[model samples]
Target: MTDLNSKPEIDAPEGPAPEGLEIVDIVVGDGAEATPGATVDVHYLGVAYDSGEEFDSSWGRGQSINFPLDRLIAGWQQGIPGMKVGGRRKLVVPPHLAYGPAGSGHQLSGQTLIFVIDLLGVS
Candidate 1:
């Protein structure tokens, strides 16, 4: 069987990124290092910056989701590896790096995303 989850991109951005998100500054991981184009598996909790409502997570995957950091929302792609194993952090990702102008459908449209991430283990 094919693992439909193997694609390494989130539909790609249709045009320029949205109007709010910023890259801040990229931080490197300690031992849990993840390069710009590498994948990082992790556990996380994501919330909407506007409504503070929970949007998505891998915590309920019954295990950690092998989140391909490179393929993830730009916020995560740049934010996840700035941590060490067992480290926790808050990512203030603006929408430009998140879902772009369209915002990944409805849940994220015109909004920045706040994420509380734990660098449980990186593979």
Candidate 2:
């Protein structure tokens, strides 16, 4: 069972990166569902697909984050909707949907990222 209070672990991916976004639910919640543009409170961990190196984590910061879905990456905007509070989800986001192409200037550009997100609340 997934522990919503703790940070998640992502195994190194095998083979080539996927061509598109992949969303998987780890723990399904029974609370209010999230809308496409809703603000959310979540705890998340992010890692690089190729190296399995951790890039970011809300748990590392000692708290969850709250933000509007539309203000995040495309992968998030597309992946977060339909989730519910108390759920945990994994999203494999390609470069285009994440930080964009190699020269897009964001540190994570040109790379595929994996995120395990715990939904704490939605508004």
Candidate 3:
């Protein structure tokens, strides 16, 4: 069973990185739904798709984060909506949807990323 209160581990990716954004629901919640522009409070873990190396994690920090959907990466902005509070979701984000193509300056640029997110609240 998926645990809502703990950090999630992502399995090593297989095959080449996908060319587009992919969303999967690990646990569906019945609470308030997230809207396109809603601010959300969530616990999340992020890893590089190719290496499966962890890059960021709210869980590691021992706290959740709150941010507006519009302020997040494209994949997140696109994938997070329609998810409800108490849900857990997985997103496979291509470089374009994540940081961007190579040489974009950001360290994560040119890299595909995977994220497991647990939604705690939305407003």
Candidate 4:
């Protein structure tokens, strides 16, 4: 039998994000929910939509990252709230909410970013 709790593969979207950022829960957690301004620790995989290339991932390095929810990119700041600790979420962030027209680094210029995030803690 398949484990119901297993995480599915998160792929970049080929189509446009439907009006505003799209947030979907992959695995629901019973822990505390993340709030604005909260310092959160999470594991995230970032993919470029155009070529479905992974630009970054905390899981690859076997380490999680911690940052204030409000201090991240506009897309992350808006989308991270309401996520529960130990939960996983998928976010489809459009250009405006992402890095905008300038984008980030060389691989992500003017790209729509897709992220699969696992919320590890909130403090």
Error of 1 at 9 (Å): 28
Ten-residue segment with the worst summed lDDT in candidate 1? 2-11
- Reference-based lDDT, each prediction: 0.58, 0.94, 0.96, 0.79
Per-residue lDDT of candidate 4, residues 52-107 (tens digit): 87889887787889999878888899989999987888898878788777635644
Q: Compared to the true structure, candidate 4 yields what TM-score?
A: 0.85
Instruction: Report the lDDT of model 2 for residue 112.
Output: 98
In model 4, which range of ten residues has the least summed lDDT?
1-10
lDDT of 1 at 119: 59
The C-alpha local distance difference test score for the whole of candidate 4 amounts to 0.79
Residue lDDT tens for model 2, 1-123: 777877898988999999999999999999999999899999999999989999999999999999999999999999989999989999999999999999999999999999999999999
Query: Per-residue lDDT tens digits of candidate 1, residues 8-100?
Result: 112223444335444332223346655566666666667766666677866645466676677787778766655665455567677677775
Candidate numbers sorted by lDDT from highest down: 3, 2, 4, 1
For model 3 the TM-score comes to: 0.99
On lDDT, the candidate that comes out on top is 3
Q: List the residue pairs that clash in candidate 1.
A: 21-94, 21-95
Give me the runs in candidate 1 sitting further than 4 Å from their true place.
1-31, 102-106
> Where is model 3 more than 4 Å wrong at Cα?
none
TM-score of each: 0.65, 0.98, 0.99, 0.85
